[model samples]
Target: MTQTARRDVDPSTGEAAPPAFESLDPRTGEVVGRHPIHDEADVAAVVREARQAQTAWAELGFAARKQHLDAWRRMLARRLDEIAGLVCAETGKPLDDAKLELVLVIDHLHWAAANAEKVLKRRKVPAGFLMANQAATVEYLPLGVVGVIGPWNYPVFTPMGSLAYALAAGNAVVFKPSELTPGVGAWLARSFAEAVPDHPVLHVVTGYGETGAALCTSGVDKVAFTGSTATGKRVMASCAQSLTPVLVECGGKDALIVDVDADLPAAAEAAVWGAMSNAGQTCIGVERVYVVDAVADRFLELVTERARKLRPGGEPNAHLGPITMASQVDVIRGHIDDALRGGGRAVVGGEHSVRPPFVEPVVLTDVAADSEAITEETFGPTIVVQRVRDADEGVAQANSSRYGLGGTVFSRSRGLELARRLRSGMVSVNSVISFAAVPALPFGGVGDSGFGRIHGADGLREFTRSQAVTRTRFAMPLNPMSFGRSKGTVRRLVRLVRLMRGR
Candidate 1:
């Protein structure tokens, strides 16, 4: 297959054929599947087709849409193992982890389908004393279509955060999965087709960065992106040209804070698992640690013990898996190398830990606060452990990063207080990344971490736009909106305003 967009000549017709790319298994560098590289024209055509499908899908009403969604959900459940196998093959994650991701996707799909009406259906609101003669209502209407650019890590769970909710809100979706996992994206669309079968409510277009960029400017009503912050900016710029709105869920340098009175073993376990799971490709994965001096040594000892024993392989019993993206391997190694060069001590795996696709967990101690390993996202199975004087100092260190995406705090008495201090968008008390699984919590970051949210009530509304409407129930004797008002009418209206205000 052509790596670039250069066309191949077809001998039968003597015409140029579109380019294609291959999705490779990171474990063995073997080709899993090949996908067409959808260009700008192809993306535009898909968006136009989605718009036509969206009108009928939206007219199906909330209850009808939910029924179809429920049918789709059941279909997914019956074929859960099949879909999970596809995820495992393309993304190189262990089968168990792949299954876990599918479970979350199914749960979010159920929640979004079941709750879209209650959360987004038109509802009545009070008109207040001044507008008592009017009936007011606010409804969230579908945006026609949405474009979802997903990541490779947790491919099923992460993209569904936008895809399922957008569909539930009555919008057709055009999904562009990461180049590394295009096969998974295509599989989802095919299964959705089996359930609905009437229209292309969910469409998948595959390729590299150019394909994703094409979707942004393809006239979709909105775009939801999950990737690095740098790429999110580029997507935003492209969407701006078409006046299309975008929701960006970017990378994070998430931190876990350990207090003096915390559960040592649980904190250690959560940290290791959060930082190293799926080869640490999680957008909200824990990357840094700030422990109080009172328990720093104990926490470090426990975390080191847990991280050391973890193994990365394609085996079912392996604690972790290979890095899905090849480019990320260099980024992970750079952070470890920079940290060590800056006088940080390696407690476990170090510069030699990166072994091509699989990187053993690396635990660092006494790392400088401004080191790239602490400031930027590592997105690998490496973590830096820093000691602070107290919980207050720990919060300060955790909030130092420019990215405020998600965080975790392990404290007995002051869990909430410590969690509240971090600048992160979501913080889990005594648990790592707990907020992400809950279908009701808003997920996204502030500043460089990106903007907008996906999941929960907010996520349901993210794919739609709000519309306010009012109707006159009865006419008033005063006729305040008329040009025939007397000079004293203004005085009477002022008195009425005071009366409404109880002045």
Candidate 2:
């Protein structure tokens, strides 16, 4: 913990070694691990290797691939704590939270492996009356090679949403993990190698933005990216060169709605946790709350009381953790300052609560709906509570955002009714971030929050392309498709069609 970052030096030349990136411990600024800075050529070679391996992998069929994936899943489950410790050290999150995310990753891996066959296997499809002489079938085929650009937050769980599902669908993967968390990505790749030693189906390339861009342009069949919307646009641009499809999961200004008849205490607790947990680094974290006027005052009181009691620290008992990326501190502070300057006031922690590497929970009220704090994705431990006239107003406020990722609702009567009105990809009723825990539910969003899906049947299909096949079972007596058809034949075909339509 005491050691900071140190560069690799070549003893003979007395100079730095090849370019590389280091993973720093956010808590103490210590260099936890160092990885190579893979350039464009390196990325291309790795993708080529993966492409070569994909043929054998896809040929193994579903059962053999699942066996290997299951082995990898077991290894991850058995060594959960070891990997979680690395996650905790690199991300500055609590050990328990790291373990929780890893558990979800394992569950998703198992689900992807177990259900890939059922979801992707060729199935019989009925042909219409005109094509009754032909047998039709459809199946999802692997895209050969997939490139995954992972995120720093929830590094293991988030990228695995693409990696596991892709591998299960019979595709090889070339992962360019975030430079800030290369260690976790390397560990995952090593574990998979242990499970399936012969095939080099999974590869990890480590670097910064340039490396990610290289991955996008690499000769992979697809690229799955999880990061900011702006970066997603760049990825799409790069992929456009080769017409490679991309799946993007981006930022969100997610909101939580509180109805007039909501359980006030429950809503307050959810609000606090949703806005403050993991130091509010969650992409789908609740940044704003629109409460009904009838219960706004009491709900504000409860939220303020709970938020004040919480604090961020590196200790095991700390309610929250430090901001993983140091640069994001300025963004959080700027949002708070903007809120306060725009006639908004903090109910608990103020702008001064922003300590370096850590920020205390800040609950803001009276923030304007058009303000940056209200409309933008403030990915810090801050919450903005705005009052609304009724549930309809609350819905309107929640829906009025460019990013529709995930949301929550607290209501006794209209929980489901109001949830359906939300314009988000997923919504949880009477809870916070519950939809993400279920492996069956897809995790994705619409608009600027990014498109395509992960972590469900839909996720499995994202890494594949649908293919249709038809076989001629028998030939019809009427040779309608013949090139040398007589006028009598044409008249008979017309009569048959008219008779079929009850002419």
> How does each model score on TM-score?
0.97, 0.96
Q: Evaluate residue 450 in candidate 2 and report its C-alpha lDDT on the 0 to 100 scale.
A: 96
lDDT of 2 by residue, 114-181 (tens): 99999999999999776789899999999999999999889999999999999999999999887778
lDDT, model 1, position 190? 95
Scored by CA lDDT, what does every candidate get?
Answer: 0.90, 0.91
lDDT of 2: 0.91
**Residue 274 deviation, candidate 2, in Å?**
1.2
Superposition error at 502 for model 2 (Å): 8.7
Candidate 1 per-residue C-alpha lDDT over 1-503 given as tens digits, one digit per residue, 9 for 90 to 100? 12233457789999887888788888888888878999999999999989989999999998999999999999999999999888888878889889898888889999999999999988999998778898999999999989999998978898999999999999999999988889999999999999999867899999999899989888889999999889999998888887899999888999999999999899999999899988898988999988999998989999998998988997755788788888888999999999998999999999899998889999998887778999999999988889999988989888878899999999999999988889989999999998999988888898788889899999999999999999999987676687897878778988988887866
Candidate 2: residue pairs that collide: none
lDDT of 2 at 422: 95
Q: Which candidate is the best by TM-score?
A: 1
